[model samples]
Target: MAFCTSTDINCEPCLYNSISVPGKGWCLSCEEGLCQSCVDSHKRRLATKNHKIIEKCHHVASIRHLMSQTCKNHNTILDRYCPFHDDPVCSLCILEKHTNCKGILSLDNVAKNVASSSSLFSLQQNIANLVKNLSQLNKVRTRSSKQLQSDKIVKYTSVRAMRKRLDKHLDTLEEKLLQELSSKAGTCETEINNSLSEIESKTKAAYAVQSNITLLKTMATDVQLFLAIRDIDTSVTTETNWLREFANQHNTDELNLDLNTKPMEDLLRTKSLGSVRIDRIPNHVPINHLNMKEAQIPREAMCNGIDQIQLYQKIHIQYHNEKLVEILFGCIISSNGDIILADGPSKKFTVFNEGGNHIKDIHLPGTPSDLTEISQGRIAVTYGNSKKMEIAEIKDYHYKTVISVRTVASCWGISCDNGQMAVKLLTERINLYDTNGLRIQQIKVEESCPHYINDITIAHRHIYYSYPYQNSVFCLGLDGTLIWKYESDFLQHPRGITTDGYGNVYVVGRHSKNLIVISKDGQNGRELLKCNITPWSVHFDKHYNKLLVRDSEGATVYKVAFRL
Candidate 1:
């Protein structure tokens, strides 16, 4: 839980393990190993590019030995050593201690052959084993602590709940006993839960040992590993002892409710004739935890800023006196900042340069309802009435279709993240598709939205869909669990939704006629800009901090700039 610096974690892989290649430098803020490949990527991100990185030299590995020079006992020079006890001693200890021990030697002599020692590998394995054990124990203790808090809250709530029930059951003896039973058992539960707090002290010790050993294994060379192994083992052993003490002291007590008859000697007492007395039986059972959260999530490889983006750029397909009723239903900006759009009335997909200049317009087979940037400059567009979709690309200023497929039903709204795409159909169901354009799964929009699923977008590995009538946006995980829905202050008729590279979502509110920026976690929302007319679409250029918004009344695109 303690944040370690870049020197603690191994530099990120430069394609392969950095251990095999020399580190170009270290990103101190990210605590990541760096290579030339990520240099531009890191500098592009709004949150991370400003991070300070130190370029490392070839001799950096040699300096790993410096990690072992500190003496734990004296915080001084570790010069003397005792072979019998296998412990390092400082100069103050050479005169005052280890004088009577036989076969005493210098600290360096004991460590000279450590890299070649048979125990080096064994010690490394031991350290790894301890890491696994301590990590699991730490997680279990942490969960237990949270569960304990929940149970405490439940107990407090039950007391008030039982008090009300007692009033209702005043005439019934059985109900009176039930209320007394809960009250007595709640007290016993608190004591047992309070006692479990002792595990925290031990878990922290194990965590410290695991961190130190893991850091040594990663940042230290083989010889450094050998020299630090004994001291690390001592610290690990102390943590192990703490864990043992926790196991010995911690217990899960079971509450028992029994009927206790009131004494006949107290005839004037108004209390219930029979009462429930609670007792606890301490059970020495410990909890074992399991099930990993998930494998991992990959993020955007590069970051970009939008300082160069200009305003008042528009893309309109007008053939003198032709009425283009529904123009831009949805739009997307590719990772390279090229713009893509679903031109509904024109029945085509439009591509624009990062500067908003019209490039190539690839006419679709039918009315293109919604568009999502698939990858790079490639895009997937859905047909409103054709019940079909196709993957297209804009390369070298030319429009080319990659593939076309007919779906079971017409899907209007589409979005893609990672390799997955979600298509929002007219029936208010989202069809999930893999990279091959094959429908993998379908998710239903069950939230209370009086309107249609206007636009679907994916970000942070989750799906975000807008409903103008609901005046809100709902965020759901890829598995279809609704994480949170925002319908608060800044939102009016939130329509199109898209996430920036940093996980912040930008949405257009048709009713409020403003651009809303909701945080990635869905905890807050703020109106970033107010449009003169209701904005039909809001899309973020993945390569830059620029946001592209098109008003409903015109073909004009508003290029706005803001920090993540």
Candidate 2:
């Protein structure tokens, strides 16, 4: 080990390099020269108390490079390299984020000859390219701003011209319509109040019974089951009868929104002067890509024609408790590397540890389609052709549904962000709903693949959807406007889609029998891997870069070592 710049000749500096006078000791674990004061302070902190330390020697063999950098998240030394992300991380980060990432490199090997590597030269060239592109974009944005001001004036002039041309009889029509609107609003309020009261009472009773019955089952005792059996039977029977009655009597969806001059309603509203719908102006603004850096793998590997996950481990989860069944559609990995898979044939969610050892399995009410993590031990799962989405909480290897909401039709892929959910309906539209199951917006695709959406993923303002039947993928804005559409020869039956932190999209192609990576702009694509088994569902942990893929053929889930 080489001496650090912090090491002094007269008196060993403190653990922190800034101290002028020192003379206490050295932390062998931290590999830094420490003073008596720092040594005392170090032991006082809970995280560093047990670290190895020794008296300072003439030649302090402390870490010179490692101490210079730290993990941004944990605020500790960056000592580990996450090969999946191609970034240095701390030990704390390894468990918090990279537990599912299989192959991790040490920082020591990554730093050796890094200065001479072409990566540094490429980075310099990128910076130069970014500067040039950004300068041009700034000019374009300035021009657009000026054009916007001019357009505003022109639009205002047109509005005034049209208003002057309108007839004076409009006031009588407006007054009559306002009265009818107010009357309708009053009636709607009363209907909403009645529904709310009934819903609240029934929801409370059903939840109470569900909790009691689930608790009874968990207790696994004859006495508890016997005690709750009568109440459980009564509650279940009452709720079943109430559901049938409510379905017949409910006036929930009778009213329809319209944009016609009169009461004439058209589901597809187009070519109207006043259209109330969600849309976006085409994004023609040029963005500087080089400065907006994405996660970078060893471009050398990519350039050298190494286009695969490199090392992948598969866990064939066919049989559970001596019964074999095929998995449904999805897979998710917890922060601790616990694999939870939804099996359609068994109607169960099976779990396994990082080492592929069987854990506990949770039963589902129906066939599961897709699942997304809600919290550390909770997830939201969708049931295919059932039109039901259930939120489940996992505790001690047991799972129970806490909430369930019905979508408009058969729900397929489900992803949630900002407490709002984007659910793909069987009718080839994505419905945005609030936490309380209120539909906020419906995303209808008119450009392409207007048939069926296999999977959808959300990241901030961007929504990604895969068109399996059409062999295409589309990136859209939150307002449901297409940002860009990608159709590739490499993509055949794109079943699952996910995005990395770099805005790059990854899609699994069932027909192509490969995992494909599409650039952030949807302009370029390359095969990530040629699969042994056809892949259906795919998910990427952006924080960890670990890829979880489900094979459509069987109960096998492949944990691929995904790199940037």
TM per candidate comes to: 0.43, 0.49
**Error of model 1, residue 531, in angstroms:** 0.4
Model 2 stretches with alpha carbons more than 4 Å out:
1-109, 112-328, 447-453, 553-564
Quickly count the clashes in candidate 1.
3
Candidate 2 deviation (Cα RMSD): 22.0
lDDT of 2 by residue, 1-564 (tens): 011334452224432455576555656455566767777888898999997555543333322222235455877866677755645778999998889976687665554433332343344343333334333433433443454445444544543454354455344444444444445444544554565455555555544444443433333222223222322343344444454455345323232222223222321242223321111233233322222122233344333332434535455554332232222377777756787777776788788875667888788788888888766777788897888898888888777888888877788888767677787777757888765566799998664343554688887678888887768898889889889988988789888788665566778898898988777777778887788777777776654445677665433444334343
User: Which 10-residue window in model 2 sums to the lowest lDDT?
Assistant: 286-295
* Residue 157 miss distance in model 2 (angstroms): 63
Each prediction's total of clashing residue pairs, residues at least 3 apart in sequence or on different chains, is: 3, 1
RMSD of each: 23.9, 22.0
Which candidate should be chosen as best, given lDDT against the real structure? 1
Point out where model 1 deviates above 4 Å. Answer: 1-328, 395-400, 448-453, 553-564
Candidate 1 local lDDT, 191-299, one digit each (tens): 5445445445545644555555565555554434545665555555554555545546543434455555544454234456466555544444333321111110111
